[model samples]
Target: VQILDETGKILVDSGVQKQYVDVTNTQGSWVVTTPLVANQKVQVRVKVSDGSLWSEWSEPGWMKYELPEKRASLVVGEKNSTYVKADGTLWMWGDNEFGQAGLGTTGGKSSMAMKIANLENVIGVAVGSNHTLALTQDGRVWSWGYGYYGQLGDKNRTYSTYPTPEKVPNLDSVVAVTAVGDYSMALKKDGTVWRWGGSSSGVEPQKLNFTGISAMAQGNPRNAGIVLKSDGIVLDFQGKQVPGLDGVVAISQGDGFSVALRKDGTVWTWGGNSYGQLGDGTTTNREKPGMVKGLDEVEAISVGEYHVIAMKKDGSVWVWGNNRDGQLGDGTKTNKLSPVQLAGIDAARIATGKSHSMVLKKDGTAWSWGKNESAQLGNGTTVNQLNPMEVQFSSK
Candidate 1:
């Protein structure tokens, strides 16, 4: 394998470099070191041989380099994973049984990362229980996979799954999208909220007349979607406002509860507590938002099926709720009713699945633990891990 510049000048040759192979076969990655110049156009070609047979050099795969920066993001679903690169290309992996990976096929599953074909200029992405949505730089929205509840926003509530990304009809100039638990929600650039799929009101996106809305959190099945107005007031999907909360900056809705982060560095939660997801030191469900004990200066929050994780401003991570699958990452399977700090690491962002937890470290590396039933851990195996493990991708 060799990397060549636009003039066909070989810059890095791998033929004489140290090669790495997996003896366990479960490992599926190789490390290739090369120095890349900004705004450089490069291509790579590879050939193979096996004692008795030799293969010709493969066609060159071209790529353009951008200024190196850690601006990428990741989202983990119930059985799939989506990653958006700094260059605006989206990539997916994990279970594709329902075509949720958006790889243009509902064919079984793939442990290898597959770039979502034809998806470009993607500025943001969100994944639902079995569907996916992407927001482009031009404000166009695209959707695919399980549309049983009309979450695709195509105006039809048919029980179908799209293998490829299809533009959501009747929506444009959208700034954000949220796909979760059979339902979908979008916020237009006009400060208006639009909803579709699985909401009690039915399938088509109905415009909520409330302006000054800035952020939203979609409930995960049977829970009400909540949004934050510019004044920091919280309102439910039915347009009814929830009192006792103000100055909210961000929000997250879980399986049966909703969480709000305030400007004062406090975390508040409401709704079902069957799994102690509220993290208030009890199993009592609160109809109104209540402060989560022992957490402050929270920078971001991520919620899974019945668990929640908070990243503090100091770069520490804290978790609570369901630990049946070790999603809590406390090195124990015991569920906690109050938040517990996950020691020994600092993170820039956090993403959660139904039963797994992942964090992108400040150093640009990804780590995950818990449910690996569908290889969601991205560690090239189908084994559940109770501790954080680095995810390695195969090199071409």
Candidate 2:
């Protein structure tokens, strides 16, 4: 067997190894010790032993990783942070507290470049505030990390000490899942949903069945995604009724009020209305969903602990509600009652952590702005970011 670089340079030639003297009857590998640059060039040839004659070299197989590229799908947890490239292998880096890094017991947070322990064939990822969830090709869910809130669904409260992938019970046919703050909600292929985690309301609603859920929105750990029902209202995953208005395509809830986007592109807000967080064209609060009269055509929205960011179909960004600590990303500490566009850059995708907001551009690069105290902005330092800044992903 032999390994070659893309330029036809031989990297490994097992045919010449002295240890392979009787290799004519067994499968063997030639390890190249040289430092090879990423995407440098590579192919492998396998020789099978057949009696006195050697088999022909096998077809060339290129060596390339599968994560963090143009369509980079990522799995970010407290530790063992990972992302998948277009080809599909996963790469991760971060604090490995509690064996979430999945490299093994030895694969603690400080470990380097090791493949995630015993994990592969992953296609989707969801991260809670402390744990992580991975969805596989078979529609099964795998979880690792802290399970204090029964987030890992072990049915017992024990911190997972290593990167052990466990199938989530009662979720064999899930189609989509979201894990934020602490709890998790997964939508099934049949449009029904299931949830687990102590964060939910002490009492859950019953009979939550629907034909299809077009969009879902999640709140903090205790609050869950208000699944938009076919009857034009929102319900908890369990079919119990929940608070909020109709025709909501997206909902972003913060500490004070919850914001919802309707099918007509208008915004509706309810819940905590203190500090004018509802943005209903007035400072008064409403227990039921009410339209934000002047603003319309919102495509997507994200809620921070106290603020909100919305995206229009034309690649424009809007911010309003809470601005203390500058979570609004509008370059000011002033609370806004109407949508305000972020200057300088165009946004295509919107994602928000506790207080920070991240946007993915159409060109494949990612930029994050807003509160950066915890280095959530990924710009190298812990300083706050009031505007968008590019993230320098490791080349590996």
Candidate 3:
């Protein structure tokens, strides 16, 4: 057996062995030890020998060597944290009073991150106040946790809580899922949005009339929904376009405000500014989107209950708004009316709970801070961290 490059250059050669096979031995496999570049095109050729004479080499079989996706993702809820490792395995920790941990038990809390035993191939996850939703690679959505408000979207509203994963029926081709408060939203591959739970939508998933949505964001305390259309326009759930907000590449909603990241790397925010979560250097809320003060070259942004986190193109993280619980990760509990750089850390992705913050570094390590009374930080303690602390995960 030989593995060759596109140009027929041998990359791996498995020498002939003395092993013999009978007619019944139809199933066979080989473990190739050669290290190939990711996404590199290659070919394979195999031949059989009968101890004396060798058969002709078989026709080349074309293949591509793609390394497993190694990007880690983090999502934080009101008092729980969900993590998806590079291997597509899901983990949960912290508050479980309403069974948000999805460990098949309620009224219990886990200080250390535990791997979800029955869920796998999870590409994305979203959490509400007490419920959780997971999106698999095959476009299926699985949910658990509080269902009294129909947040589970399983069409069974009689059950108040689900401690384990249950399929959200009639939901397929879902490319993304997000939940906040008691409502959930899903973005389909066809650019349509489906919502369930909350006061407006009931237990069953209801397809919104709008289409061409590329991404979405939902607020925690306000129950507001914002969507980013493929044409770069940002619109509210009521089909109203946000004034002066266009060319948006991403959008996020917090307690009572919403944020948009433009293609020029500038951030615009509006809505509740009680804690200056809008980052406009003023406590007054605006009816129209305004440019966040002193934020530029921003690559990504996330919103918490009353705080905002923005990662710049240089890998630096900045925070502002409600810091009463030190959710800003600035080593202080003072709220900043303007964006302040979070020192000593480079972030690859960021997420925020109601009163806590999380960062996933490029090196695959995760850190958390702020409110930890429910052990949401996953640092083996329930004490709030004014500074970032490394999260502890179980080996098993």
Best by lDDT: 3
lDDT by residue for model 2 over 1-396, one digit each (tens)?
666878878866655544456643454545443434455557866756544676677888887522233355543332233455444455444444554544444233332233454565566776666666776655677777666566666564343343566777656666666666656666667676666655423112122455576445566665545677555667654666655466666665665467778788988777776556777645677778777766677787777665667778887777777666566677777787766778865766676655666666667666766665444455655666677777656443
Lowest summed lDDT across 10 adjacent residues in model 1 is found at 22-31
Q: How high is the lDDT of residue 160 in model 1?
A: 69
Q: How far is candidate 2 from the true structure (C-alpha RMSD, Å)?
A: 11.3
Ranking by lDDT: 3, 1, 2
Model 3: what TM-score? 0.82
What lDDT does model 2 reach? 0.61
In order of appearance, the predictions have TM-scores of 0.78, 0.66, 0.82
lDDT of 2 at 113: 30
Give residue 360's error in model 2 in angstroms: 0.4
**Candidate 1 backbone collisions, by pair:** none
Task: Arrange candidates, best TM-score first.
Answer: 3, 1, 2
Q: What TM-score would candidate 2 get against the native?
A: 0.66
Q: Per-residue alpha-carbon lDDT of model 3 for 41-110, expressed as tens digits?
A: 9999888765567789999999998866657889998989989987789999999998889889999788
Summed backbone clashes in each candidate are 0, 13, 0
